[model samples]
Target chain A: MSAPGSALIEARGVSVRLDGRGILTGIDLDVRAGEILALVGPNGAGKSTLLSVLSGDASPNEGEVTLLGRPIGDYRALELARLRSVLTQANAVSFPFRVIEIVQMGRNPWMRGSTVDDDREAVIRAVEAADVEHLLGRRFTSLSGGEQARVSLARVLAQSTDIVFLDEPTAALDLRHQEEVMRVARGLAAQGRAVVVVVHDLSLAGAYADRIALLDSGRLDALGTPAEVMTAERVSRVYGLEVRIHRLGASGRPVVLPLRD
Target chain B: MSPRIRAVGLTLLLAGVVVGGIVLSAITGQLAITPTEVAGSLLRAVGLDTVWAPTDPIVESTLWFVRFPRILMGLLVGAALAVAGAVMQAIFGNPLAEPGVVGVSSGAALGAATAIVLGASVLGGAGIAVFAFLGALLATLLVYVVSRAGGRTEVVTLLLTGIAINAFAQAGIAFVLFVADTASREQIVFWQLGSIAGSLWSQVAIVAAVGVAGVIAAILLAQRLDLLALGERNARHLGVNVERLRLVSIVLVALLTGVAVAFTGIIAFVGLVVPHIIRMIIGPAHRGLIIASAVGGGALLVLADLLTRTMVAGAELPIGMLTSLIGGPFFFYLLWRQRRRSGGWA
Candidate 1:
C-alpha cells in the first residue's frame, strides 16, 4: 500500500553509460502513484534508458534509485518485480506460444511455490481488460503487430503490479487502437496504479498523461502538467523544429504540431 | 481429451515404449531369449523362486553379464542426453540449442582422444571416461566464462564462443590422432563414432547415477523454464534470477552430456531430435517435455541400437551415425516448416 501523492519511484542523480557512450547523464525525477507520467523525447534522447534505470532493469552507473521509500538496490529482484511490471518496446517471442499462454506468463511471480489458483482468473480479467480476448487461441507471432502490442499490454496488466512501465505500447497501433491503449493507461491510473509511458506521439501524451516529462539530449527539458510542458518554445527547442500548440476540444490539453519550414 | 490428460497419457505411453524397448533390446542378440524368459530370469535373479526351469549356462551369462549392462547404459545415456537438450533449449529460449551446440561433445571427444593416445591409466580401465567427463565440463565452463559479462550472458557471445571452442577442440583431437600409434588411432576413431558394444555394468551404474540426478534437476527447473520462454527481461520480471538459472542449467547440461558421452562416445542428435519430436507431439511445457523426452530418448536409442545390431549380417553400424542420419533430415524439415509459416528464418 503506497501513500497517494508520494513518489512510488524516485530517481536522484541517475546516470548511465553503455559501451563507453553516455546514454543518460545526471537526471532526477519522481513518479507518484495515481498519475500517468509520459516520457516524451526525440530518438536517442535516452528516454528508454531512463525508463530502464527507473524500472531497475538496468542499474545506473553513478546514482541510486529509491522505490516506495526504500533504496532500489536494497530490494530483491522478486520484491521489485512484485511492485512493478514493464511492457518493453518489443514483445517478440520466437516460439509459437498461444496469446493466452503469453498473458499467463505475467502471473509467474505470484504462482511460484504456490498453486496457480487465481492465475486463470487474473489472466482472463487482463485479457478482457486489454481487449485481447479475441486473440486468445491464436499463436502470438501470427497476430498483426497492433494485436501483439495489445496482447503484450494484457501480459503487463495481468501482472497486476502497482507500478507499470510501458515503452511505446501503442507504436504499431492504428489511431483507434492507440487511443484504446491510452484509455487503458488512464484506467490503470484511475485504479490508483502508477503508470509510466514512453511515447513519441505528443498529441496522445498531451491527451492522456497527467504529467509529461520532456527530455532532450539525455537531459530533462521540462517536467510539469501536459499544458505547462507542451509549450511551443519548449517543443521547438527540444525537437529542433518550429512548432505550434493547439488545444484539443474541451480537454484543455495542448497538442503539439510542427510548423512548415 | 483435455490437454492435461493427453499429456499424462502421452507420458505413460512413452514410458511403456521405453520399457518395451529395453526388454526387446535385452533379448535381441545372437542368443535370442523370449520376453517370458526375460521376465522369468529377471524375477529369479531377484531371489524369487520361479516355476520355470533353469536357463542354459551361455544364455544366462550373456543375459546378465553383457546384454543387461548395454541395455541399461543405452537407457541412461539416452534419457540423459534428451533431458539435457530440453533444459538447454529452455534456457537459451531456442528449440535448436542442443547440448552439443556448446562444444561439450567436441571437448569430450578431445578428452577421450587424449586418454587413448597417452594411455593415461590414472583411473585404470575408467580413465577414458573420467578424462572425457572432465574435458566436457571444462569446455562448458570455458564457454560460460567467455560468454558471460557483468552477470549476463549475451546470446551471440555464447554461440560464437561455442563455435570457437569447438574448432579449437577439433584441432586438439586432430593433433592427438596424428601422434597416436595405429592401434590407439583406431580405438579413438571407433570411440568417436560411439558404441554401447563394450558397455559394462560398472559404466552403466556410473552413467545411471549422473543421468538420474541431472534429469531430476531438469524436471525441477520446468516451471522457471516456462517463464523463461517469455524472454530474459520478462523472465527476470517474473522473479526468475536469469543469470543463476542459466548457470545451473549449464552445469547440469554439462554433467548430463559429459557422463553420457563419456560412457557411450559422441552419440549425436539424440539430445536435439528427441526433445524436438516430443515437443511437437506433446507441446512445449517443460514439465511434460522433460519426462516425455527422457522416455522418448530411451526408446529411440534402444531401437537404434537394436537396428545397429540387426541391420546387417554379422556387422553393426555406429549408433551415433544412425541418429544423425535420421535426425539431420528431420531437423531440416522442422526448419523448412518454420520458414513456411514465418516467411523467413528468425
Candidate 2:
C-alpha cells in the first residue's frame, strides 16, 4: 500500500465524450490516500463522469488512468475490484434480497483469496458504521430512499477496499443523514483510504473534504483547499448565481449559500 | 423456518414425491405390476434374486423397457427445464424470464421439425437433437441481443422480443408441416404436443447426460448469478464479468432447453412455474433456488406424467398440455400480483 499522503490513482489529460458531446475534457487529477477529495460542480458539469473515469468504471476517450502505478485498463476487473469500491447513484436491486445479504455481497471480490477471512467482521463494522444494524432483516426493496442509500453505503464500506468512490451519496438523505454520510466519508479517509465523492452540497464538501476540485463545463475550474477553490467570485461565475461564503467553526470551514435579493 | 432448513425440508419432500411418482408410474401402467415386483425386479437386475420379482417375462420386460425409460425421461427433462428457467431468471434479473416463455422451446421445436421434414437420417439418429440445440442457441442469442437497451433488459422489451421470436419460429414450423408427408406430419404434431411415450433407453441417456451437466454448471455459476441481480453496471463494479457471465448463461440455457425439447417436443411452463415457486419459498439466492427448482421440477413433471397416464381410463394425455393448462393460470396470477404491487407495468 502507498503511504497515507501518496497518490493512489492518477489521471493524466483524461477526456470523455458520449454521443458526440464532450462530457469531460483534458482532466488531470490525483486521488491520494488518507484524504477525502470532493468533486463538486453544477448540473451537467461532469462531476460524476470524472468520478466514473477515475474509478475505472468508464474509459476516457483520451488519456489514461493509473491505479497503484499500473495502467487502470491493464488490471482485470476482479483485481480492480479488490483495490476499489464504488457506490453508484442508483442502488436498485432487482430481487428482494435482505439488507444483510446485500451488504455481504460487498465481500464478493475477496471471496477467492485468503482475505475472505475478513468478510464477517467487515460486514459487522460496516453495518454499525452506516447505522443499518436495525435494517438488517428487512428487504432492501422495502426500504425508503434514504434508508436504501445508507444500506448501499454500508455495502460499499463492507467491501473494505483501499479506494472508495461515492456518487451523490447524500442526494436522497435528510439533513442529519446527510451529515452522517459525510462523517462516514471522513472516517474512511482517516482510516487511510482514498475517498472520492461527487457531491452537490458545497458546504458539506467543504466541511469534510481535505481538498475540493470544482468542475465547470467538464473542466477542472479550480483545485485546492476549500478556502481557495470555494471563493465567492469563482463560485458565482461558474454557477451563474451570486453566492456568499462564510467561514465557520474552529477549523474555519467555508459555508456557501446563494445570495437571494 | 430459516432458509437453510426450509431448503433442506423442501428438497427432501420433493425427493419423496419423485420416488413415489416413479414407483406409482411403474406399477399402474396398462399391465398391472405390484410395487414389490417393481422393487424386486430392479434388485434382481442388479443380480439379487428375490421371490417378489415378477415371474412373467412380459411383466419384467414392460417394467424394464417401457416404464423405467419414460419415468427417467420425465425426471431428466423436468430438471433440465427448471434449471434452465432459474438460470435465465438470474441472468435477466427478472423472475418472468423462462426458456419456454422466451421462445427457446419453440425455436428448438422448429429445428426438430425441420430435421424431420428434411429426412435427417443421413446425419444419424442424433440429427434432430443437434438441430434443436442450434435453433435454441440462435433464438436465445437473438432474444438477448434484441431485447437489451442501454445495458438493461426491460420486462416489456424482453416479452415483446419473445413474442416476435415465437411467432417467427411458429411460422417456420408451419412451413415445415406444410411440406411434410403424412407420417412425418403426424410425428411432428405428436412431438409438438410434448410426450415421453415410448421413450427409449438411448434417448433417456442422452437427456440425462446433457441435463446433469447443465445443472451442475448452473450450480457452479450460482454466486455470480446472484451478483447480477444488482444490475449490469453494479455487478461489474463488484468484479463480475457481466458480459461473459451472461453469454455463458444464455448458452447453458439453450443447451438444457434444446435437449429437453428434442425429446419431449415443447413442455411449457415447467421452467416458468417451478423456479418461481421455488424462489418464493427459498428466497432469491440462486444456489438454493437452482437446486430446489431442479428437484421440485423433476417431482412436478413425474407427478404430472403420472396424472397423464392415469387421468384417462384407457388413454394418455400429453404432458406438455397438462403443464400449460396449469401453468397458464399460475402465470396470469403472477402477472396480476406483480401489477398490483408495482402499480401497473410502466
Candidate 3:
C-alpha cells in the first residue's frame, strides 16, 4: 500500500519524439495516490501523449517513468496490467461480445493471482459504479457512443488497479454521464487510488480534479489547483482565446468561459 | 433458449451429426454391409468378438482399407481447416478471414505440386508435407505483413492481399504442372481439385496428429483471442502479448492447413463456412466456437464426401469443387451483409 500523497508513478524529464517531431519534451510530473490529476490542453497539445508515456503505452525518447518505485519498463505486461488500467479514446470491439463479457475481461490480469476470487465482486461493483448494469446483456457494438464510453469505464474500473489512466473518457459522453465519470474517478481516489485523466473540457476539469496540469506545445505550462492554474491570462494565452474565469459556489471551483467580445 | 443451454444443445447436435456421418460414410459405399456389421467389425478390431462381424473378406477389407481411412481423412482435414479458420479470424480480428480465401491452401497446394513434380521421393513420404508446411508458413507471414497497415487489418486490404497471394500461388502451381511429366501432371491436376478417394492410414495418422494438436492449442488460446477482438492496443493493455499471440497463431494455422492440404489438396471454404456458422450459432466465445467448429466441420465434410461419391452414377465429383460451389455464394452473402451494415467496403 502506497502512502497517500506519495507518487504512484513519477516521470522525470520525459521527452518523446515521433516521426522526427517532438510530441513531448522534458516533462516532469508525478501521479500521486489519492487525487485526480487532470491533463488539460487544447487539441494537438500532447495531453494524450503524456498520458500514454506515463501509462507505459509509449516509451519516452529521454528520461524515465517509474511506477511503484520500479522503472515502468522493468514490469512485464501482466505486472503493469495489474498495477494500472487505461481507458483509450476509442472503444471499438471487433466482435459482438456482450457488455458483461467486456467487463469480465478486465479481470484478466488478476486471473493468475490470489485475487482471482474477487473477480465477480469487482465486476459487479464496477458495473454499478459506471451505471452499466442495465447494459450488461447488450452487445458492445450495439451500444450508443455515450453508453460505450460508460461501459469502457466500467471495464477500467473493474480492473481494480491502483493507478488508472483515462484518455478523453468523457469526450463522447453526455453532460450527466461526464459528471458521473468524474465522480467515479473521485470515488477511486477516495479509495486511495491514483487517477490521471485527459479532458478537453476545461470547466469539467476545474470542477472535479484536485490538481490540474495544463499542457501547451508538449510542455507543462501550469501545474496546481484549479484556481491557481485556471487564470484568465494563462488559459487565454495557451488556448489562443480570451477566456474569463469565475469562482462558483461554496467550493470556489473555477469555471472557465470563453470571452465574447 | 439460454446461451448455456443453446451451447450445450449445439455441442450435442454436432457430436451426433459427426458420429452419424461417420457411420453413414462407412456403410454407404458399394459395400453392402449393415450398420451392425460396421459396428461389429469396429468392435472386433478392438479385440471384441461379435457375431455381426462380417465373414466376407471383401467387405472387411473394403471397410478397413478403403472407407475407414477416407472417412478418417475427411474428419481430420475438416477439423483442421475449420479450427485454422477460427484461429485466423481471431488473429486478424475479421470474420471474413479464412485459410482458403487467404491463399494458405493454394500456397500449400503449390508446394505439394512442386514436390510431386520434382520427385521429392528421396526425402521419404513426408516430403510433400514438409514443403507444404513451408509454403503455407511463407504465405501466412506474407499476408499478415502486407495486409496490416498500422495495427488493424482492414477487411478490404485483407481480401485484396488474399487475391494477390492466391494469384501468385496459382501461377506457381501452373508452372509446376507445366514442367511435370504426363503421369505427374494428372496427379497434380487431381490433387489441385481436392479429394479423399485413396486416403491411406499413414496419411490419416499424420493429419489426425497435427489437426488434434492444433485444435487443443487453439482452445488454449481462446481467452486471449477473445481479448484480441477488442483491438490490438486494448488487448495489449489487458496483458495479452499481441505480437506473440499473432505469431503463434499464424504458425498454428500454417501447420494445420499445411498438413490438411498436403493430404487432401486445396479443399476450399471449409475453414470459412464452418467457423462462421458455428460462431453464429454459439456466439463468438472462441472456446465453444472452436470446439463446435471442429465437430461441425468434420460432420460437414464427411457428409459432403459422401455426396461426392454418390451424387452421380459411379462418378466422383471433386469435394473441393462442391464446397466452393456452396462457400463461394455464402462468402458473397457475408460480404453483401457487411457492406450494407458498414455502408461501404471498409
Q: Which prediction has the highest DockQ against the true structure?
A: 2
Candidate 1: how large is its RMSD? 2.8
Ranking by DockQ: 2, 3, 1
Residue A34 displacement (Å), model 2: 0.6
Q: B1-346 in candidate 1: lDDT tens per residue?
A: 5446767898898888888888888778788887777787888888886755246878778888888888888888899989988987776666766667668888888887898788874565367767877788788778766765543344556668878988998899999999999998988888788898888787787788888988999989988887777778888877788888988888888888888887677887788899887776766778888988998888888889999999997898899888889877876776677567657654
TM-score quality measure for candidate 1 = 0.93
State the lDDT at A5 in candidate 2: 89
lDDT of 3 by residue, B181-270 (tens): 998899888878899889988888888888899999999999999999888888888998888999999999999999999978889899
Clash pairs for candidate 2: none
Q: Give the clashing residue pairs of candidate 3, or none.
A: none
Model 3 alpha-carbon drift over 4 Å, by segment: A115-117, B122-124
Query: What DockQ, between 0 and 1, does each candidate earn?
Result: 0.58, 0.85, 0.84
Interface RMSDs of all predictions?
1.3, 0.7, 0.7
- Compute the lDDT of residue B61 as modeled in candidate 3: 96
Q: After superposition, which runs of candidate 1 have C-alpha atoms over 4 Å from their true positions? A: A112-115, A249-251, B116-130, B141-165, B180-186, B335-346
Error of 1 at B139 (Å): 3.3
Question: How accurate locally is residue B12 in candidate 2, as Cα lDDT from 0 to 100?
Answer: 87
lDDT of 3 by residue, A1-261 (tens): 577899999999999999999989899999999999999988988999999899998899999999878999888888888889999998888788889999999998888764655999999999999999999998898999989989989998999999999999899988898999999999999999999999989999999999999999999999999989999999999999999999999888999999886
A1-261 in candidate 1: lDDT tens per residue? Answer: 566667999899988888998888888999998889999999999999999989988889988899977888777778887899999886777466778878988887687654566787778889987899888888887898889889989999888899999999989999888998899899889888899999999999999999999989888889999989999988998899999999978868898888875
CAPRI class of candidate 2:
high
